[model samples]
Target: MSPRNKNTMLVKLRNDSQWSSWTWQQKLRLHGKHGLTRFFPNIRRKVNEQYIKYIKSYKIEITPYLLSLIDYDSQGNPQKNDPIWKQVSHIDLLSNVKSADYNGVNLNWEMPEEIHYSILHHKYPDRAIIRLTDNCLGYCSYCYLAQRTLDKKRKTLSSSFQIKWNGTLEYLRKNRQIRDILLSGGDPLLFSNRRLDQLFKDIKDIESISTIRINTRALTFNPFRFDPELIRIFKKYGLTALEVHFAHPKEITQEVDDALSLMDDIGYRPIILWRSPLLKGINDSCGILEELLVKLYERRIVPYYLFHYAPYSPARSNLSTSVKKGVRLLSELRRKIPGIAFPRYTLFHSSGKHDIPLVQEGTNEFKYEILANKQYIVKFKNWKDNWVIYPDLQDN
Candidate 1:
């Protein structure tokens, strides 16, 4: 059946009185519209029962807005350029390999023993995270939060603190060192404007918190979400910066341009920064990377960190490229692109963000050593320590 038919059948079956008041996400769940099954039924059928099994392992969601951006004609057809296809699509990798936590990032590991809140993860001394919601407008295949949020047994903060931010605010108020609090989660933009305004207002009152970074991918998922009202709220709170993820150039659409234009026109105190994983098939090439960087620069958005793809999730193993290749790409970009356009390439570890050596090695042979202090030691075979080149370290 077509997606429209499936959705129609789903809507017709709902008998709950609160259905009308449900948010976009609630409606999606009521209709089983969380994964590839919601669209391209033929492809889902082609993969057979394995598709069902794969989503059962992970909560793979593609919002209707993001779903509309996918180039169905070119999807899975290598002859065409379908960067969006590679990003959200499920492949043989998910079915063949069992799910494994590759990055080792867990809520428990970062959370302090004293804090009872699930929304806060105080990993570093000066920075902390306020996981607003465990929900997102769309789900990326390579999301770092996949293992934590997707697990049914795990309770997420997506809905818990919607009405109040007292717990997190109190914690921030007491700990003045936390200058920044990243509003992250499935995507904090998914929350209603009223809820968001309240959340930011509470934080804005805290004198110690100078920076409020809004982490979201809604620019690609649903650019219109940044309406005038939302922009007004953001301005009211003195939003410090916006950290947006754009894995491939294809994800940058006319709508994204307009959304960015809106932000520009609004004259925000918030500086926009671009960040994305260095995915193998999606954007490993220098040509694609340069184009993406140029586009972001055109929008006055600064290129930030390009994180090395974490291979922990079996679903995105195919997307992970070698650190050597990542280094070469970064080095080449530095040579060709302007210094301002270059994003620092780095690896994220449990300890903190570590610089990925920009060393140009002859072969792929490399060894990694995890020191007792949680620092990493990576050495290229047949190369002396003098050959290693390190990028300027930055805390994430």
Candidate 2:
């Protein structure tokens, strides 16, 4: 390990040999995190075999940096209620829960209106996304894509996304309507720098494509990946911005700040923006989120979108906060924090993005009004003509 940077309390850089020796998978293994083995010996000894079998059903991976943040006693007993642990570690409550696909974004493959290619999803004419890989440095327990990855019958990574590069590019060139291309997957940053360099170089030249964004969680897992060479490539290619996923304030450490600072020096204004699902018990409180959002703005990272947790399955249903609760929380934050510091609390539906109703002026009591089977034309206070229908109010 190298000495820590004086200004920020993170390691300046790892030695060359130290960096080369450990692959990403090797780091996971060394941290005792690939499977149930990361649990304390006492817990593992007492846990039932059925519980162990349940955890094995889904995928789980934790990075070295993240593992260090988990709280444990001197005797190596992992804490049961730690927020970081809740995000990745499996709980007994999910054992009997049936698996489900909540978002149905994958069903886009069946719709031919905008999906010109099998792997690409173009919900709108002007925007599209390319999935680069099915691998990520850290795996969140509530990940939407986990449904596909856990299914043995389906292939998560297909040749269409990887091998048919020329054909995909040709489709983009022919349409001339796509102005934005977002590279995402398990995490695009997990792709090799050389591979990313080639992809950026190819996309930057397309006249129709004006903005490119890389969605990643690497800053939380492996900040060192943002080395000087990678920074240089992003600058050369005129990379628009990066959307990073961070669920809790504890995840924002000095190391993460140092990584953002690297992008700051390269003339990347508002370089990084954050997007996170509001998970119950983890980051649902106004105090936790208020502090996290303020810290983000101070670091030059904009609070982009705070998503309402999707009701994916019976197992994950507890994570979804009710619309009434979400609105009340956002209303509280709006009252205390500056408007610029607040993020749009939204629900993602097949139709479009609908802002969760913030306040009902006349009523002194704050509560959700259930409008039955009605189509709502949700309007934006700031932007005229920008609106989406409320898909359903029954759930509220």
Candidate 3:
């Protein structure tokens, strides 16, 4: 839907009491004159039961603010280019997914391993990821979190807050070492403002968590989700900062700019996670990656990381962008742009903090480091301890 159409549609829906009361599923039917039928072009030939069911039930919602930025008429599915598509469509890619370790990321869920109660396993006691929401606004064809995040119906979000979600809160309270809560789930923004506001307040009460960074694509997937009211709620409850996951420059639309302006007005600071799944056909070029970083800097959003695509489900051919391509792009981007604008081109390697930087080793091998490994495997071991080699350090 075009931005104008989306806005017009939203206004129409809002005015209609019946529309406002409907579940997201119902809204899709109203979105276009046709409801379930709208998804037929994409799903008709496919045979994935979970996805077929999802598309059957899932609503197609693009807010006016976000839709306005899209070129709906020219493109076959303008929404596909929109970040909203990034969130919703990737689950289909799950059927074609593969493992991340052979390509670069050492994948594992702390689940049965159980160092802690998370899908995440961290090295330090001072920081850890706390997943509050179990829903994603869109399912990426190349989602790393597929094993944990999918299956929408069973995911817990109690209409009543104090009653059902209290157990999650109690779990966090017991783990005092977690100073930073890197909010992950499907996407934290998938939750309603009321649910999130209460959740943040409860976390703030814990006192151990100082910095709250949300690993989300809301800026891309649902930019409209971040409003003045949401920003106000975040600020009031001391939600420190936001991390917006914007992949390529194409993903950062004018609507995102407008939303950022709203956030700017409310004094909400954000760091842009300029990471890509590096999908083969999607965005594998050094130039595209560099342009994305440049645009991010132009918007004053910090370029954080260019992630190596996690090969999880469907297949590597469908999802994994070559490790060689990732490393080359990192080198070229670093040479072309300044350090800040250039994201730390890295890959998430496991339940551990290993973000392997795509770098050239002497024998034509590429290597990076595991941030914190169970055992010490130094990818970049500096010999600063050599006393005679650096004699100046003796007196200093």
Best by TM-score: 2
Runs of candidate 2 with Cα error greater than 4 angstroms are 1-26, 29-34, 46-52, 91-93, 96-116, 149-153, 158-161, 265-270, 313-315, 360-396
- Candidate order, TM-score descending: 2, 1, 3
TM agreement with the true structure for every prediction: 0.78, 0.79, 0.70
lDDT values of the candidates?
0.65, 0.63, 0.53
Tens-digit per-residue lDDT, 1-396, candidate 3: 444344334445446544322133223431332422342334333433544454443323333333333443232233444433443344344343232322222333333453344334344567766565556654455556544554333335434435434654565677787788777776777767887787778778887767777777777656666767788887787665567776657678776888789877998655545455665555667777777778888888887666666534323445465555566667766779888887665544333333444554412122322333232112321223221100000000
Ranking by lDDT: 1, 2, 3
TM-score of candidate 3 on Cα atoms, chains taken together: 0.70
Candidate 1's residue-wise lDDT over 1-396, tens digit each?
Answer: 332223332334334453223255234431133344444444446564655665655555654445544454323222223566567655445544423333334331243553336677787778888877777776676766665655434566646574336677888888999999899887898888998888888888999988889999887766767777788888888888899999888788887877777767887637889999888777999999999999888878899989986535534446666576778788888887778888988765444555666765434444444445543435433222333322211111
Give the range where candidate 2 is weakest over 10 consecutive residues by summed lDDT. 1-10
Error of 1 at 227 (Å): 0.7
In candidate 2, position 356 carries an lDDT of 61
Candidate 2 lDDT over 1-396, as tens digits, reads 211112121121232244422244336432222245443444555443534554455555665556556666444545666677777765454654432223333431224565445546677778888767666776676765555543224466655555556666888888799989988877788767798899988887789999999888877666767776788888888788889888898888877876777777875543677998887788888999999899888887889899875444323554655565677788888877777778988765544444566764312222343334343223232223333332222233
